[model samples]
Target: MSKAEKTKQHIIEKTATLFNTKGYISTSLSDITQATGLTKGSIYGNFENKDEVAIEVYKYNAGLLGKTLSRSFSDEYPKALDKLHAFVDFYRKNWKFVFSNGGCPIMNAATEADDSFPALKNQVKKSFELWMSKISTAILEGQKKGEIDKRVNAEQYASLFIMLIEGGILLSKTMGDQSFLNHALDKITHMIDHELNILPS
Candidate 1:
């Protein structure tokens, strides 16, 4: 990468962590500068303003999530059921990072940007849709392979899984208890298995 691109990526990485920890509203320009060790002029030179940095940080955070999910699906788990398990396992292992200081960036941005920033809110919504679509596709694939019950509705079940996960994460964060996540995962796993006509082991 070029120097400018490298610097821009550095700024985005630093800001993403800050935003995830301190929140978009709470993370100030000073925080970004301090974290990045860049002056106000340098920060502005790279980004137009705090909002611009925040938007880029949100995208960076989303990209990180996508990469993690992608890495979980390897050739060893080519089957849809195995792929689904891998996806859930990824979240289970990374619960700490996923539910860090400020919680899910998508949820945070969705709530904060709704009335304040429509454009950012739209991006958050699109990210959610993408997640749901992926899960739905997996369900459909499993159904085709006879691993998942053909009677079950892929889109509906996918929505349920996503909603349950997001809700569970929020609840876990609010209660400051990781066990909530375990319970939530248990419920979701059972739901998926039951829908697939398989008893949960």
Candidate 2:
């Protein structure tokens, strides 16, 4: 990468966690400067403004989340049902990585950006749309492969799963009770086993 691109990436990487944990409005330029050890002019030279920089940071944060989910869907699970289970197991096992980073980036960003920060809000919206689409696509694929029930509604289950996961994370983070998340995951597991999965007669 060119020097400018490298510098811009440096700024994004340094401030991603700070913005995720602190929220955009609360995270000031000084925080980025302190975290990145770069001067205001240096940041400005790389980014058009704070909002622009924040947009890029949100992309970086969202990218991190995408990588995690992609890894969760890795080749270990040959069937879609197993892939879904692996996805849950990924989060369940990575609670520390999730909670330590102040919760899911999409959830945190959307909650913080609601009715505010239009550009950032739109970013959050796209992230969710992509997530929902992924889940729905997986459901449809499973149905085609005879792994999931053909009668199940792909879009419906997709939205439901997102709601469950995001709600679970929010409750767990706010209540200081990790079991809330596990409880939600348990419900998801039930839905998958009894509702989505096809059991042999």
Candidate 3:
């Protein structure tokens, strides 16, 4: 890519975790400069302002997560039901990655941006919308294929799944324990098998 594009990406990558951890208000220009090894002038040269840079950083952080989940849906699992299971398995297996990266980016941003950062809040909302849509789509597809029960409410379950997963991540991060997330995922598994899955005839 162009020099400016690469530099912008470098800043985003370096400060993504910083913002996720320290938050938008708490993460100062010094933090960005320190993380990216760029002077304030260089940072401003690459972006219009801190808010602009933060918007991009949020995208970068959320994108990392979105891409991985996207793969779980597209790759390895042909059946929609299996894809849903893979979704839970991903968090179960990769909670460390999520925690180390400063917790789930969506959760991080949601808490920070809800009241103060409107721009970042909008971005977070879009991410949630897309995520909910994907999960609901998977459920609807499964019903069509006869793998999932048709009576299941795709949109409602999608909302519940996001709530449970995000809530689990939040609780886990707060408690400094992974079992909170595991408990939430366990509930999801039970819901999938008993509430959503179709029994063999």
Clashes of each: 0, 0, 0
Query: How does each model score on lDDT?
Result: 0.80, 0.87, 0.91
> Which candidate comes out best when scored by lDDT?
3
Which pairs clash inside model 2? none
Model 1 spans > 4 angstroms off: 198-201
In candidate 3, which residue pairs get closer than 3 Å at backbone N, Cα or C atoms, i.e. clash? none
Q: TM-scores of all models?
A: 0.91, 0.96, 0.97
Displacement of the residue 126 alpha carbon in candidate 1, Å: 1.7
Worst 10 residues of 1 by lDDT: 192-201
Q: Counting only residues 3 or more apart in sequence or on different chains, how many pairs clash (N, Cα, C under 3 Å) in candidate 2?
A: 0
Per-residue lDDT tens digits for candidate 2, residues 1-201, read: 999999999999999889889987789999999999999999999999988988999999898888778764667666878777877887799987888887898988887888889899999889988888777877788899998999999999888988998899999999999898999899888988999998832
Name the TM-score of candidate 2. Answer: 0.96
Q: Say which prediction, candidate 1 or candidate 2, comes out ahead on TM-score.
A: 2
When summed lDDT is taken over every stretch of 10 residues in candidate 3, the lowest stretch is: 192-201
lDDT of 3 by residue, 1-201 (tens): 999999999999889889998997788899999999999999999999999988998998899899999986885888987899999999988999999978998988898889799989999999999999999999999999999999899999999999999999999999999999999999998898888989732
Error of 2 at 44 (Å): 0.3
Give the Cα-based TM-score of candidate 1 against the true structure: 0.91
